[model samples]
Each structure stands twice: as C-alpha cells, then as structure tokens.
Target: MPVLRAPEVRRPGRGDPAVGHRQAAPPPDARAVRRRRGPDGRRAMSEIVFLFPGQGAQHPGMARELFGREPVFTEILEEFFELLDGEGKRLRDDWLTDDPAVPLDEGRRAQPLLFILGYALARTLETRGVRPGVLLGHSIGELAAAAFAGVFDLPAAARLMEARSLALDGSPSGGMLAVGATPEELTRFVDPPGRPGGVVVGAVNAPRQTVLAGPEPRLGEVERALEDAGTPGRRVPALQAFHSPAMAEAAEVFTAAFAKEELRRPSLRIQSTRTARAVRPDEATDPGFWAGQVAGAVLFWPALEALLAEGDFTLVEVGPGRRLSTPARRHPAVRSGRSTVIPMLPSTAEGTWEFWTAALDALDALP
Candidate 1:
C-alpha cells in the first residue's frame, strides 16, 4: 500500500494577483473572522469520507472475522436478525457466522446480510477512531449508507432492506451483462431497430463499462450484437434485472413500503446515482429518488466525478467484494490521478481476518 501525504498548505506567492490583492486589503480585525483553533491552538483534524459498495460486491464470508473479534459486531448482527424477525423473516444464525457452504447468496439473505456486514465494518472503523466526513453508497449499498449517515435507525434500515429484498425475490429472472464500450455503443446494441425482445441499459459504470439487463433468453442476441460491433461483454450473476424498466414493479413495491416508514434527513452528504449530483440530506428521503433508483440508469461516472472535484480523496470500498472498486479504478476520472481506491475484501482467499486486516492497513495508510 502507498500512502500519499496532503500537500503542504502555504500562502500564495507574493507575485500572485490574489495574494497581492488580499495583502492590499485592510487586515481583518473581527474576532469572528479568526480561524477556530483547537485547545492546543492547532487546526481541527482533517476529514475522510467513505463510499459503500452495493449487492454485486457481496461474498460468502465477508466481515466474519470482525464478528469473532469484536462483541459489538456480534451484537449488531443479533439486532439485525431480530429486526428481520419482526418483519416475519428470520435470517439463519449460521449466516452471521459465515458458513462457507450455506446458500447465503440468494437475494433474500444476501441483501440484509450485506447491509449487516457493511454496518458492522463501519462500526468497527468508528471504534478505531475513523469517522467519515461524508458518505456515498452505490445502488443497494445506499441503504447501508443511509443508516450510517443517520438518515434512519439501523433496525429501520434492516426492516426496509428486508422488504426491498422480498419485493425483488424471483420477481423476474433476468441477467445483467457488462459491456466494454462507451454508453452509446451499449445503447446501440439495446435499441437496434426491430429488435425482438427488449433490453435496457442498467448502469453506465464508466467510459467503457455499461451493464445491460433484460430477459435471460434475449441476452444472447444482445451479446452477439455487441460482439459484432467490436464490444466485448460478459454476463454478471445478478438474479434480477436491477436498475432497468424490468424492475418497475419491484420499485413500486419498495416505494410503498418506504412510504410507511419515517425517514429523516441524513447527517452527512450523499450523492444520488439517479442525478449523478450531490443530494442534500432532505432530498435523500424523497420517495421519488428511491423509486427512480430502480428503473433509472445509475450515473456512477458523474457521481465519481463530483467526488473527485471536491479534491483528492482516498476511497475505500466497504462491502463484501471488490466489484465496485475494480470498475472505479478503471474509470477515467479515477485513473487520471485524483484519488486512491481500495477494497475491504481484497482477496478471494479463505481466511476473513487476513483479508480485513490487509484492507484496514491500506485504509490507514491513505493520506
């Protein structure tokens, strides 16, 4: 892991016009204008924001090490199960322990469990004195991010996530294919004249990576068209067609469920995948935004661009796998030298602690 230090803060050179003009102005005498200082007369600590990864990033044994090492992690998992039980869905206890053979990958178990693991990891990080100044989550990960940002209680998020997963479970069996081409190229494949079955572009992950979701049978036609157009692609293991028109019914169900729950403004900033722009805390609770997330394209590129525009950052993908981090690193903005992106689950290895510790070390080493 490489650690890059923030550049030294210095006054502008004497010849700089801005500096010369400021110098020419009368010195501020008001106490209110003075910089706030700590007890030791030093500036406040710098800030670090966290980005949480979504569903496709989950792995079988994510965050299991933390549960064994920390009682808080175990307690949080217990609370999550209790919440699910209240919703008439009891997640098996073995799921929390990270049993390698269990079929926890099913949407019903995977969504809530991923939320629990991410929450536990975030809590563990906080116990270690790492606090986020801002937060953003990708797709399903947004629910976890919302809880972390104080938009809703952990139990509320757990319940809502349960409802969300139930709504999506076996609704429509569709596939998500990742295409290696510009958005236009991918759109051409989906919107070809007289195409038999319909395929919708799900997410524009980067300049060259776009995900398409449609009926599994029609996937072959889309793939063939992409190949003929010089764009290579592969099918992702998503059970449902997320972020496409195919998910409209699921989105409607989720919207109704969300309407019954009271949502508060987030304590921290969040970026919307729908608008690819920064959303105010109040704006995040809007039902329309949540609904749009299901049937709209995830504008990840613009969201990433907005974060980078804030200046350099060290992005740690907090989730079960490295799917999001891989695409993020490949994005032009990320590759053009703005921030450091690392994944908490860095390996497909068996031991969970080793993987977590390695990721923690990488995060700590960031500037």
Candidate 2:
C-alpha cells in the first residue's frame, strides 16, 4: 500500500472551522471498499468495526476544527444541537472554546458531546461511503452506535441523551477511577452485590485495566487503597458515579424521560459493551436496556473478545479520542496483525494536524 500525503491547506470563508489545516481526500464508497484485494488476494479489509468511545473521551475543542470543515459533520452536529435547543448551543460553544463554563467531565456535558461527536463521525463516514460491518461502544458511545445502526433516529437519540444528562444531574454525587489491575485483582475492592454506596467495578476495559465507580468518600478511599496495594489508579474525568448503584435513581428517571420514543431494529450489527455480546433483536428495542446502561457496568473487554473470536476486523475509533483504541491495540489479534486499529480523529485539542494525517491514512488503509 502506498502512503498518502495530506494536501495543501486551504483557508475557508467566514464562519468556517477550517483554519487552513491540511485536508484528506474523500474516502471511497462501500462497494469500492469491498471490492479491494490485498497482496495475498484476500480481502485487505474484510470487516470494519467502528468503536465509539464513551465518557472520559470528551475534551475542550473536540472536533472543533472539523465542525465547519467537514460538511456532513457540520450539518448533523448543527442539527443535533438544534434539537437540543439552548443546551445544545451551550455545548457547541463550550466545545469550540478553550474556556468552557461547564467542565466537559460533568455528565451533562460529557455524555451528549461524546455521543454527538461519535454520531456525527459515523454519519460522515457513511456519507463518504465508508460503512462499518459492526458497531461497538464503551458506555454512552453505545447510544451513538445504536443511533448509527438505526435503532433510533438521530432526533430520538438526541432526546434520549438529553434525558440521560438531566437524569444524571439528579443522581447522587460520585466519581470514577481507572485502576491498573484486572477485575479479578480488584474483586476485593468492589462492593458486594446489591450494595448501595461503596465502590464497584464500573468497567472491565482490558485484561489488566478496570474502572471503579462509587459515591464520594468511598470512591476516594478506594483510589487510596489501590495506590497502597501497589496498583495506582488514575481518575476518570467524570462527575457522576456511572455504572454503579448510585445511578439507580438516575437510570429510572432516564427510562421514564424517554418512555415514548420509538425504537427500531438495528439495520447493522451492534456489539454491546454493557452485555459484552451482540445485542439481540429484542434488546435493541428495549428502552430498559438502553436506559439501564447508565447504571450498568461496561463489559468492554469481553465485548472486544467476542468480536475478535468471530473474525479479524479493522477497528476504527470513530469518536474524538483514543480511549477505545489504546486498549484495543493491546488485544492479541491486533498485536499479531490479524486486525488493525484506526482512529478517525485526533485525541487532543492541539493535534488538529494529526487529525488530517490520521484520517487520510485510515482512508488509504481501508479495503
């Protein structure tokens, strides 16, 4: 395969997000992609899996550069913000500016932004004729994946996300921490089943990485405990105790808030991180399952394992950051080159140049 180079930057007119940054050529359509043949005469990119990152992926200035530069992304995101009304504008302003009034870590800001970014990226890819064979998401990213898969229209998904944000606002105060230990290693730190306030394994990210969520002091205490146990934990940028009992009330509120939204069968396959498997046809339409995700542990590691067991895939990180891509790179299939990881966007606010290079590389690398 030939290495593609970024084209010369072209400054855009007024109100454009284009800062004269290098732009990649448009990607090939799905039919063209599928027809590609590798050196060995086998499909170079047989399966394309789009991985959407959940919370802890949001940051100020995320996708700001692409907002106006990419037409499809700009349109879909603007439409989504309109559906959200005033709160939507606030989110847009917060995301585009360096100084945001509300921190992105707060559930209200992070959840919707991440969802919208993921949704927009997926849609933009489709418009350029790049479609995924399977969709997987970390937490709130699943909502994005579902939206892209046609489980719910964009409007409904936006409504559901807004409802989720409001619900989280009413939930108990808490936080999350990423521990450098396996779920088995952290079993002693997790609360017993049905427990209400202590820390719990909120996510199983990889073989040796897990996330813990809990209410205030207990969560803080666990962070300290993990450090003392020789496995220090890094704080996940979040303000609510997601995937823990502390979100029970929030989950109920979220379900009730979007009770009337229509649910449809997904047109594409969705590998659910909450259940660590492919979402059943029934589960796809279950409001409870979607709502319950807010308070349920994310079984990301197992979900990835399930996908790997099925076949080799070119895992594309469709969202803003490398949160999902990093752990996925450690998977045996990827390490052995049976699969590959491609991040469609840059991970940080300052890597706008990197974004173009990465996107172009992805377009070229795709079969």
Candidate 3:
C-alpha cells in the first residue's frame, strides 16, 4: 500500500500540547492534498476516523449530566438501553447515576458501558452528517466497531458483550500495570522464559508506553522494580489481567459462545488493534480473532501508525476519556496542523452543550 502523509505545519505556540509531537514535513506529492476538491468546490470529509477506546477510560457518573444537555445523545442512549435486558439496565443505571451499588469499574460493567456510550456517540455524530471513513478499536472496543460497521446486528453484539464479559469477569482475577519504558527495555520483564505464567506485555500503547498484565504478585514485582530503576509504572484500574495467558481459559469459553452469533460482511473499513492494521472485512468477524484478542497483545501503536500514515485523518475519540487521543497527539508521525486528535466526551465534558459545541468546532471535520 502507498503511504499518504499530511503536510507538516508549525505547531501551535507554547502551552499548546501539539508542540511536543515530531511531525514529518510532507514531500512534493503531498501538495495535491490541499487542492483536492469536490464538484461543488467544497472540501470532502473522506478521511475522518472514529477511534473507540476500551477499558480503564470510563469516569464516575460520566453520563449523569449528558441526558439533559444533548437530547440527541439521550435519544440514542435510551434506544440502546432498550435493547438490553435486566442486567444491562442495572449496569446502565450504575454507570449514569451519582453513586450506585454496582461499581462502573466492574469488569463486566465497564465493557458494555463503553460500548453503549461509544455507539451512542457514533449515532449522534451521524445525525450531524459526520460519518467515519474508518473505525479503529482497542481490545473489546472492536466489538462496537464491528457493530457500527454492520458486521453483526445490534442484538448479536449486545449478547456477545454479555457472554464475553461473564467469561472474563468470572475467570481467575489478575492485574495490569502501565510501564513508562520502551519495548526494548521491557524485554527483560516479559521475554524471559520459564517465569510464572501471568506476566507479559498486554498492550504496546506507544513507543515509550506499554501496559503489562499478569498475576498481581508478579505485576507488583515488575512495578516496584521499574520504580527502583527511576521509571515508575502506574497501576491500571482493572479487575482482571487481560491480553495475557491469564485470559486464555476465558477466551476459549468466549470463542465457543461467540461463534454461534451470525456475522455479515462489513459495510465500512475496520482497523483492528489485535493485528495493529487494517485487514479484510471477513477477518474482522472471525470467532477465533475475537477469541485471540482476549489473550493476545494489543498492537495499538502500530495500528495508530497505520491510521496516521493515511493523510488528512482527524482522530475523533468517540467514547469517555481522552486516553487514546493523548497518545495519538504525542505520536511522532502525527501532523497536528491537518490531522488532529479530538475527544467527543472528554473528562471535562460534564454533560454540557457548550463543551460539545466547542469540541465540534475543534473537530472541524466538515467544510
């Protein structure tokens, strides 16, 4: 495939986050990207990508204020909830209310909550004529992307979520830690053979950032060791260790259950984090692929590179928190002047119209 890179313009001044990124200045052929025009002389929105984040990105009472502020958002969310049964309803209540019995961070609750919010936001964006050119998801987020891509019907996706959550949440509990080191430095901890089974790099989020998952005891050792060496690792808020052998048992059960669900050819392009690049539409719905995603490492950095390398794409992080957007902005290949990182419902959203309007203006995906 040919590479398409956006033009590098001077980043915004100091106090701006864009200055820290290292963008490549586009070569001669990139000039046409500026002159490309539609029949009516309007700029076409052919490169806007929707980014969906997985676990650890949700916030407390995330949608509490969202209901009254954006009616369209409320409409879509309510419709989505209507499709769920009792368990889904209870989880939704706990997620939107100020304080509730079931914790939003519960492994079972977090996956579906993020999926619901992410899908609802995608629908709301569609109402405003902002459709995604491609979809990229991290781990469980792929299910939502597949749903939006029409790879599976909505009900099938919901059922898959419920079953997959049960499989993972009921498995042996584990832990995850975010290390502030590159993969080369991380080799000593994850690559050494004959060690306890739980420890391995879960996801390579960026060139300098990686998340490790395994038994809590072994993870603690790695965390303390990294800190002792002057590079501290932060504990990820997770109930179980994912993307490691710790999840292998659960993955087998999930794969068996999910295989019964029907899958159709996708309507849109999907770039999976499991492979860290775009694959054929059929590969997206493979039961084995979904199963492997549970136990395999998430190649997020390379997947992100694939998206950024395709010029003129604005990464609109559709779900809660700017976790994915933060790293994309800091990636070396990103050109902040053209391709930008936008968060639809950031931590500061607080369910307000003014904030959303500002976010849309920032996105600037439309002519």
Candidate 4:
C-alpha cells in the first residue's frame, strides 16, 4: 500500500511573521496610498489577484486546520463536501487521515477536494475584507477560479468536477514529469526529427521548469532521455495524463457531460493560464473551452507575465502548499519588488492555523 505522507511543504522565509517570515514585507507603497477603505476602516480589495493551484499541490490534511478554526471557510467547505454526498464524506475522512486508500493525486481524489478548498478560501478571504480584483488558476484550478468569479455556481461547479472525475476514470494510464529544462530544450525528446513520441509539453510553468505528459510507456522514454542528457525530472503526482493529446478522448467525455449546463460570464476579472489572457464572454459560455482545458498546455508563466505587464498586483496563492507561489515569485515583477506574493497557509500541515492568522494579519497590515 502506498503510505501517503504530508505534502512537500517549503519553509516560511525568515523575518516576515505574516505568512512565514520572508523579507520583512516592504512598507506598502503607492498602491496602498490609493487603496479604498471599507465602512469599518478595513482596506478594500484592490489590485489584488487570488491564485489557485491544481493537482500537484494537494496532500492529505490540506485545509484540515482551517475547516474548524475559521467559520466562513468551515461552513463553505462543508457545504461543498455535502454537495458531493457519500463521495464528499469519503474525501473528508481521507483528507483528515494520515493514510488514504487512494493517492491524493488521482483526479477523482484531487479535483473535487481542490475545487472545494480553493472556493472556500476565496470566500473566507472575502469576509475578511480581502476581496480580489481578479482570479487566476492553473489547470484544474481554473474551474475553481471560474466558480469564484460566478461563471458557475458552487453546485454547477461540483457537477463539472464530478464529470471530470468520470472522464479521468476512463482515460488511459499516463502521467506528467516535471523537468528542469526549458520547453524548447525538451521539445526534441517529445518528437525527435524522425521519430514520433507520445509525450507533449504539458505546461511551461517558469523559465526553466516545464511539465511533460503522455502515456506511461512514452513518458518512460522521455524520462530515460532526460537521464541521458543528465537533466533532472520529477514525477508529478497524477494517474491520468492531463494537458496533453492523450487527454483528447477524456476531453470529449468531459465536454459531453456539461454540454447542457449553464455557464455565466464572470462577474469579476478572471485570467486563464491555458489561454494566457483574460477569459472572454463567449469563452465563458462555451463548454468546449472548459473541457479543452484537459488537453491544453498551461501557459502559466506567460499568463503571469501578461498580467504583470498590465501593472503590479498583489498575488495571493489560496491553495495548499506553495506550488503557485514558488513560480510566481520568479516573475520579474515580484523579484524587482513591484509585486508581492502571499500564501494563506504554511507548507506544513502542523502550523496551518497559525500561518493562516499571520497571513491575514499581514494582509490587514498592508499599507
């Protein structure tokens, strides 16, 4: 049996007490000067974007601490679990346990739980006067973003998540491998000059971090190629190949499941990492666009760049671990001190409540 361990959590940086000590958060600059204030004197959300992470970020016990400690997060999350019926109970039971019968990376296990947690966190932030100006998500995280933006109500999103689980269940055995190479450098192995390979670049997360995906056998070939080139590659926890041609059939299954569901235009700004732009009204209503996400490459770095180009914005990673924050910090805007990244929970499961409060306090202290 695979003994599930705590998710790989990065240590909080030193000095910054809010959201793990990092560089003492710089004093709020110009952005804070023009910020709007609420009736009770709390800062209103402005120039802030809430980011959500997808599959690889999840682990057992994620958000367990927040469930009971924070009323808003607890109620909203419990409602999502209730919508899932028996499956919700099962996921909740496994989530709080140290060991799970199935791995958390499996789509069936990961997708629903992630969607619930991400949506709950967004709502939790809103109640604390941390409403976001925009929403962004990577891969499956996009669905959660849409839900928060009102593209789909919670029940509708849950149904789509269920549809996704069914589609993944029927997909071929495949997985993703994260390589420390640029997408251009990895292209040769994916489809060398004369020979065709199953692998495709699943995501270009950062300048040097890329994710490759395909059928298990083909992925093995790419992994061996990486070994030959003396490059490092790590397996991203997943049972089905997402964001690759191998997901074509699964995409069809997923689309058909939600063909008749109503999808509304987002009430707030929401960016798509898949398209690397703000989602359009037509795209919001198109079921195909959402379904195609299963077989589309995630242009996270490009999307983040595009957003940063518009202007500096505070990025809040509202999911488990620091998966999205890790890459966001590499962006020039963040590195140059123009933008900031705040994580709501610590990487480790142990100090989640403490970290959660600290992060909120930090946000309140901004400006």
Candidate 5:
C-alpha cells in the first residue's frame, strides 16, 4: 500500500532527430465506448487473460513485504539473485530497500527483478485460486507471460531476461511516448518529415493510446507538438527505444539466449507480438520470432482484438504499475460489456493479499 516514488533524475538530453511543432488542436476522444446489447438480450460468457506490464511499471520496494511474509516468495527471490549474481552475493538488498548505491534503476537489474516479482505475484494470486484462462504481456512483461503460459520454466525466463537486459545495455538513446490519438491520426503525426530518424508507432495500445518510439529529439518534438495541439501525452520512462529498429542488436542477443536455453511447449495459449497470433511454447521458441519481437512493434491491439473476439474475458493486470490495464479498460468490449479488468498489485490502502481474495471473489461472482 506504500506509494513508492521514483528517484529524482534529469530528463534525457536531446539526440538524433531535431524538434518541430504545430498549432494546438482538439484532443481525440480517448474514452471507451460501451457495446450495445445483442438481439438475444443476453450478455455472453466471459473468459480471462492474465496481462503483465513491463519495465517502467517497476518500483524500488515492490513485493518486499510479500517476500517477508511468504517463504515461497523469498525462495524465488533468492533463486533470481543467484542466477543474476554469479558472484554469489545477495541481490535482495537492491530490491528490498531504497538504497541508491545498488542502482536498481538500471535496465540490467530492473528487467530481471520485475520479471521475478511479477511471477511471484502471479503465483501468489494462483494460491488464492485466481488463474487466467489465457495470458498476454506488454514488452518485457511478455517474458513473464510466456512463463505463466508454460512456455518456459522460471529459470529459463530468468536467463532470457538477464540476457535481454545485457543485450540492451549501452544501446542507442531513442525513447517512446504515449499519444492520445486514433492509430490513423498518430500514424500521420509520426510520418516522414514529422518524424526524426523515421519514428515508428511502437504499440497500438488502444483506440486512443498508441505508443511511438524513435530518436529522442524527434520524440520530444512530437510530445511538445501533441501538447501544443491540445493532445495530452506523456513519455514512458524507458531506457532503450524498444520495439524499434534500434533494438536489432538486442534481438540478436535474445535469439542466442533462447537458443542456449531448453524451451518446452506452453501449457496455455501465448499471444505473440511477432506473429500477432496465439503461439504455443514450442512455436515461441523459434529464435527468429523472439528476435523479431525486439525489432517489431508490440501487436497489443491484435492481442486485445483476439481477446475481445472471444466475447467474455476478465483481464487482470499483474505487477506494480497500471500501464497495461489503463489502456485495456478503455476497450469497448471490456468497458461497455461483460468483461472485467483488475490489477493484482496493491494500488489502494488494502493489502495485496486482501485484494487477491477480493479479486477471486469477484471472478467467482462473475456470470
């Protein structure tokens, strides 16, 4: 229930594409539309997808209390530290407290730690009889989702995450920004001269929340232009320009990492960004697909569209921040109809265990 504050850091400096602008315009309607009733006058049966948020969603003290209370949680944490810390030193200190010396903010520590914590939280929820019918994840969170869907064991996921973080270290300095426009409008905004180094739409999050990633200067210009145009926007605190061409090196590293690890078929369905299709663990193991994911925009829109087509689906956003859930709740199928979306992280005064119990009860209560 504690509100963890981000460390005070300066905004990144200018780079690559030069800045530009335009006059303010009306903001796009970012609200979710409700679905009208069908001819049968009955709502459809609902399914569920366990959604995971990535990277910036992590905070310093996430799951520290949970680790203290649960031995299983502690075991997982220790295992993660062991895998990451080849020197056999404790990595727990970096995550458990707010000490600045450990530098939990770095991509190397942040990615693996987030994955372990997310997995622990998902396991905790499962202990309370809460399980998703399907799994989906955004960005790095996809690793956790793959594990949850039984694509790989926790150890394999941990190694993959560590390799991913290391591969991304010292990469180019491009960034991502969430835009408040329809995908079409945003595409125009990021096109040709409007973009620097040819900024690409990274993720089509929702009807109104598409993310654009590219050179830092170009991204800054786009942000300023959006604000000046009366379109509310914010920069996602991401180190590398993920899902952009800039990540090709990281993708290659990820491919090698996966090739070294033994991958098995997933027990549950995994929605892949590379193929925009439901893939099994074995299929996901294709080095090309894993590598392609780094260079490709997350097909979150397709994943969501697939879920909606299933008619009824309860969506649970697991982990510290609410990035995934925020955009997902705005979907017409999830908002105006039978589906339910909830966060597993403790965002309120109530303890997470309490929240987990309530979420299970709510799921049970769902028709």
Candidate 6:
C-alpha cells in the first residue's frame, strides 16, 4: 500500500531526449545577482539548492524514524524499495523504519539505501512545493542528486548503485582518513614519488578539509604524521577506499554499466563534482564522465562555488547526516555570507519531526 510515485523512467525515444544534447545554457541575468537586501532591507531566500551527503554521513535509525513517524515518507520509501527489488537489488536493511533487528551499517547496503533515502526525501519535499533550483551532492551523494535531476529514474539508479558497489567489492580492501589539513600539506604522504603504498587525496571538501584514502595500514602512518604535526586526522569508517586510483577496476566496471543507461536532461541545474560545474546535457549522460568519478578527487568546494553563483540560494542538506553540512556551514563563503545551510535530518537520535518542520519553516519564509 506504499505510494509508488517516483517519476517514470524516461527514454531517449519516448521523451524529449534531445534536451540533454543542447549547448551550455546561457548565463543567468546579471540583474539576478545576490540581493544584499530585500524589500524589507534584510536578506531573503531566493531559491533552494539541495546538498546531498555521502556514506560517512549515514547512521543507524536515520530516515527510518521519519518513515515510522510520517505517513508520506513511509509510503514513498517503501514504494521505492519495491521498485529497487523489482530491479533485482534488495534493501538488505530494514530501511523503511529504524528496526533494531536489521543491521543498517553494512557496506553492501550503504549506497543503495542512501540513494533511496535521498530520492524519497526529495519526493516528499516536492509534495510540499519545495523544488530545488540547483542540486549538488557530496561524493557518493552525487548519485542521488543525479536521480533527482532526472539523469535516471529510481530503477536505473538502483541498478547503478548495486553494480557500482559490487564492482567496488572486487577492489582491494582499504580505508579513508579525514584530515583537517589542506591537500597540499597531505601530498607527500599520498603515493609519494618513491613509495610502495598507494594513497591519494580522495575528496576535497574544503580548503582545509580533505580525505586521504589508501590501504588501512598505510593510512595509520598518515594519521600519526598528522597528529605529530598538530593536525586533526580521523578515520572515516569504510572498508574500501573510494574515489582513488585504488578504485580503477570499479570505475571500469561502472563505466560499462553506465554506458547502457539513458540519462535524461535535468529539469533543473545539477552540478557535477568531477569538474565543479553544472552538468551539461551531454556530459551528464556520458559514461566516461561518471567513470572519472570513481578514481578522481571530489571537487566539492568548487562545486559549492558554482551553486552559490546562482543568486541567493538556501543550501539545504537534504539527506541523513551532517557530514556535508558541517563543512559547508564552515566554508568561508557560507560563514561570511548571510546564506543559510539547513540539514533535512540530524544525525542525532532526535525524531525527524523537528527537522522536517525546520525545513518547512525555512521554505515557508523564502522569498
């Protein structure tokens, strides 16, 4: 009885497929620049720009609490999981609610569950008339954003998540260490010129926040070095080091699977983490573009810049965890500006009602 209302999977021949091949969009009106003052001589929210989080952000009893508490969220999530099951990928975790019986933190279920949570939450927001003018995700979060922007439907996205995770399963086991240091400072430790190890800058979240990925054993040395230098370095609980050269084989497998998918032109702007720009129609569909994501550094900082350039936008972190919001709120741009960054769900044990109300209140106060 769950509501299965996700948009139908559009095909090239069935829908307006030519839209993705269009040339780069013209720049926004110069008059559309950020307005320091509204008619009341105060700042105002002009648009909603969704920011999706990746793996490290997820925790047990996340969106599930929302499902158990909110009828709409529950229906949509259950329906989406049904679709994913139809695609031969099952939600190994009891994702519709926070069930203590099913362990939710397993690696095999992370990507798919996160995608469903994000996609379903977006759907819930739409029922309240809150649509994203721009969309961006943190690392693995981009996959969920892609689905939100019509790159693919839930079914195709489910397949991609499973295939990508399966491919990653074949890669050597590794881990990621989050450091409160710039990529420049961490360079020498990552795959240095003369080294037997293979570490690399996996994600560039901000000027000072970068994630280093490599064999778990090698990452220990890097962590110790950071500590010795008075820098903060903590391991992100993960079994496989993603977004590094260690993911080469996974990238190849994902590329082949991605090529077969039919990516639709987005109804709104969906920024790319690969190049830190709004994804063009062709580039959005290019298998090679998505392939690069596996082994390339996540340019989250630059992509955030691209999102802010589009006038005053409410950077809504529309997924579980504050991983993306934590840094974004501290980024010089957001910290200095009057812009707001609100998270849809808090990582704590608080129920989803307060957070959901917060989002509704924020959108209600928008210009």
Candidate 5, residues 75-163: lDDT per residue as tens digits? 66667677766621434555655664445645666677777777777776677566777778777777787777666787777678777
Q: Per-residue lDDT of 14-57 in model 1, one digit per residue for the tens?
A: 23332232222211111111333446654332446567766566
Stretches off by above 4 angstroms in model 1 are 1-46, 86-90, 93-105, 192-197, 228-230, 331-338, 365-367
Winner on lDDT (1 vs 5): 5
Please write out the lDDT profile of model 4 over residues 1-367, one tens digit for every residue: 3333333233332232434443333223323423434567655333989999998988767877666556777777677778888877777777767787667888888888888888899998898788798898999899889899988888887778778888898788999999988988887788532233378889989999999988878888889989988996999988888888888888999888768688899998888998899999999989999889998889888889899998878898899878998888888888776677888775668667666665776677654
- Number of backbone-clashing residue pairs for each candidate, in the order shown: 0, 0, 1, 2, 5, 0
All candidates' lDDT scores? 0.64, 0.81, 0.71, 0.80, 0.65, 0.69
| Candidate number with greatest TM-score | 2
Residue 27, model 4, lDDT: 26
- Model 3 segments more than 4 A misplaced: 1-46, 68-72, 191-196, 333-336, 348-352, 363-365
- Best candidate, lDDT: 2
State how far residue 14 of model 4 sits from its true place (Å): 21
Clashing pairs in 4: 13-21, 16-21
Candidate 2 vs 3: which has more lDDT: 2
Tens-place lDDT per residue, model 3, 121-183, is: 787677778888899888777777888888777788777877887797666767788987887
Where does candidate 1 have its weakest 10-residue lDDT segment? 24-33
> Candidates ranked by lDDT, best first?
2, 4, 3, 6, 5, 1
In model 3, which residue pairs have backbone atoms overlapping below 3 Å? 198-214
Tell me how far the alpha carbon of residue 158 in candidate 6 is from the true structure, in angstroms, after superposition.
1.6
For model 6, the superposed segments whose C-alpha errors exceed 4 Å read 1-37, 40-43, 68-72, 86-105, 192-197
Error of 2 at 80 (Å): 0.8
Alpha-carbon deviation at 90 in model 5, angstroms? 6.6
Report model 2's TM-score to 2 decimal places: 0.89
